[model samples]
Target: MVNIPRLPTATQAPQRPKRTDKQRKAEQAAAPVSQPTVVAKAVAETIKDPAFIEEVQARVQYDSPQGKNKQALSAYLDVLHQAKREEYSHLLGVDFYV
Candidate 1:
């Protein structure tokens, strides 16, 4: 047998009226949401992989940007490759040339 007190005793604080699950959710939904700071929001956004979103956003029947952007990617890679080749070109002296 459990001994439950009908009212709060002097040592105990009075409990506020119990709210239903629906009431609690309603109150939460009604409350103003605290917006994240700029840096925090940027971090949260950058952490998310938006590739899937971008792939779907175009709503095209054909291939995604991955395949279509090969030209642009190749162009960038060519510039990078040229820079790296030039950096090591000095090491390839004419003495080593046949």
Candidate 2:
């Protein structure tokens, strides 16, 4: 047998009321202001680089092959070349023929 304390049903802490729509809207509107805009700026900067975009597209293609075929091998090699070129360009800060 377990001994349990019995208390008056009327003795309880008050619960917080649900937020009103206006209060919720105010909170949502204020939430984004403090976050740094650096992520958006970085994304914008990244998209503006054609080399980076090409490299990314190539990588996606290289990784998503449905079958092992000559075409797939050729495409994978092409993407690898593009990735190397992008890396070299980034290192030199300028395009150079290799």
Candidate 3:
């Protein structure tokens, strides 16, 4: 039998340092501190606004016989139910269906 040359085994090479510890520490220190901004404060106020919530509820509840017969309301409800079921299933690992 003729002698066969041996192939080199695959191996991982040493990785180079991407960033130094001082650089990482400086970046961490320079990171933006979490504080509520004007937009965030406005959002919180809007959420707590009773009139806004009431208006939204009124719009959701205001349904005509024609709209109900056309399954528009039912379709919206079904979509909401499906989304909630999916969220619950992801959290609890249970089969959720409407």
Task: Give the residue spans of candidate 2 off by over 4 A.
Answer: 1-14, 56-98
* lDDT string, candidate 1, 6-98, tens digits: 965456678999899999999999999998899998778865869856876677575534764987887787877775666566677423211
In model 1, state the lDDT of residue 59: 77
Local accuracy by lDDT, each model: 0.72, 0.81, 0.83
User: For model 1, which pairs clash?
Assistant: none
Error of 3 at 87 (Å): 33
Provide TM-scores for the models: 0.29, 0.32, 0.35
lDDT per residue as tens, model 2, 11-96: 46899999999999999998866665899989999999999999998877454445567678877788779988888899989996
Model 3: CA > 4 A from native:
1-8, 13-30, 61-98
- Please report, as a residue range, the 10-residue window in candidate 1 with the lowest summed lDDT: 89-98
RMSD of each candidate relative to the true structure:
17.8, 19.2, 12.5
Q: Of the candidates shown, which would achieve the greatest TM-score relative to the real structure?
A: 3
| Two-way lDDT contest, 2 vs 3, winner | 3
Once model 2 is optimally superposed onto the true structure by TM-score, how far is the C-alpha of residue 41 displaced, in angstroms? 1.4
